[model samples]
Target: MQYTAMLDFRTCFDARKDIASLLKQEQSSGVDTGADTGVPRQVRVLGQERDGAVLYTWSDVSPYRQDDVVVSHIGLYEPISKVNTVLFVHEKLVNLVNCTVNQERTLLGFTTQEKAATSSSGSPSWHSEGRHHAQVYRSYLAEVQPANRVFYLNIERDNYLMVQFLHGKGQGYGDTSSKESHMLFLIHKELIGLYHMKLSRVGYSGVEMCGQPRTEVLAKRFQWAQWDHQRQRLYYLSQKKKNSNSKMTFTCMQFYEKHPPEVMMEVQVRIYLPPEVSKAPSTYEHLPLSKKVTDQKLLCEVMTLPGGSLCICYQHPIMNPDDHHGQEEDIGEYDVVDIEYSVFMLHRGTALHCCMPGFARLEAVNIKLHFFPFSE
Candidate 1:
């Protein structure tokens, strides 16, 4: 029994030694995570092994591969002076990771100088493209006059960030002397017979919006259009209530908000409308434009519910074998005709859900049901 115990102990020791050797080899091979020594405080050029579940490395940084641009690597320069190093080789900006901190620490993006960040936008000032990020799709855009030298950022439901910059400055066509108008939206909710307007300066960073919720003055700044039915509440990245700049809302648009606000950033102004309990299509008299509504009674029925789902399902019989006897036996088709139904959740307060498909509903016999809990 004593001999057997000794043998067992020896075997365990050998196994542990083998495991350690394997781990050490993995570290050297860059296959095992234990191999990564992390980056040093001082920058250096070493390749990353893999990405996601496996070790993957990019051939280079900066999605732009052109040679006409300049690149810069900005790092935390004492957090105050902020070192902004400009690279003359490439046009697009790129950051290189040189060193790692420790065993548990990871190398992320580089920091930049404060002065470079805050240097001159409207009147030579740096700004941060903060907050208000999203991805919008299939919409139209009209430039606000006297471009505020500000950009708009679009935010989406999936945490996807986008940017839109205001490229010009000056008032629209006829008003050359007026202050450049900012294209922003006023978000609001209605209660009973009353409307509460909340204003925010939304969209991109460079495009600065007036900061206030006053309706009478700012209402004339924007052109209203029929909203696409495939959406829900318009969101904005706000700094402070009654004092903030909002990221613009609409689809398929992104802007740059890469830095911090060099100047005071705030949102202001709003346009409010009272609530209407009925979402069913009303009539041509209630419509904003002909393209905005086909049938008011039908549209009135498609709006979202207070915490309930939008069941836009048409009540027609489906194309299944049970419902479509006329087609008779395996015709080699999907046998599916989807009806339409969209849903939007009420975020606490009572807000009307808008669903305007621009077409008549197929009813219960045939309907295209949105396969999601919320429209994208």
Candidate 2:
């Protein structure tokens, strides 16, 4: 029995030695199958590929390749007085990466001094520094529709992060099919959760072409009306007409505490057009070159209750030669109409109605609030 045990132990030792030799060969081969070892932290250029892919070998393994057309870049820079050594690069700006010692590489290895990140336009300063560092584990790019063009980012107003995209079909000019959708998302400094305007998965009507001419009266119909965070109320503007001959109703839909959570108010507005403007056609291809609407009526339902009010306003005039040059006059004169709406309590539900009346009418409605929700 003792002789048999000795023979088994010898066989196990021989097998262990064979495995270690194979592992050592793998480490030397440098295929990078994700293994870690303690070694000096010097930057090493591991190897290059014929296809132009380069590998940066260090404590971590990183392979980088970039295409043209990406001009701006953002990444982490390790500064030593006047020089910057880029320890990490963000994938979003990886297009600026190059195998040769390029300008970005030069900038990375040389930063004059640490200063507050300055902003010009269309870009912001991306800098992060502290003893404890935050690292991104994984990132991915979203496949957006081709119709989604470019977007503007403004960090100053309401700390707003707005992403505007063209939704649905018919994105062509005079294409009444597709409409612009504003997706609003709010980020709070304290909370990691996202605060956004709630949308109803269902309930809203789709945009429809009314008459034969298909003149777009409410082509881009939905606009932000108001948002009272404290009250948990949100409002949006829309225009609806019963028929081709009927008058148009300016409508407002109020959302409760949660976005698209619940309907708290419904407001409809109708503007009283002046006699001269009222005589205009239901769907006129051209303006009559004069007059404007000046009065408004509100049929509002707050929560579940109903109430309304009438508003009368004055007519004003303006002269702008660039707008239109009628054959009647060298320079045409038109009426400038301004109407304002104010909400009052007493009803459980809310409603707002607005109308514009005139042959050559120009309307401007101003609603002043503590914080403006929409940006051009």
For model 1, the stretches where C-alpha displacement exceeds 4 angstroms are: 1-66, 69-173, 185-376
Q: Pick the candidate with the highest lDDT.
A: 2
lDDT of each: 0.23, 0.25
Per-residue lDDT of model 1, residues 1-376, tens digit only: 3544322223422212333333345446655221234321122221111110111111123224433233332121111222111111122333322111100111121111111222234333322233222221111121122222222222111111111111121122112232332222221111001111122233432222344322222111111122221231112221222221232121111211222112121222122111121222112222211112122222212233445443222222132345444544444334434433323222332332334333322233333333323332
lDDT of 2 by residue, 135-188 (tens): 111111111121111221212211111111111122321122222122222211
Clashes of each: 106, 24
Please identify model 2 stretches exceeding 4 Å from their true place: 1-232, 242-260, 271-329, 332-376
> Each model's TM-score, in the order given?
0.18, 0.23
How does residue 358 of candidate 1 score in lDDT?
A: 34
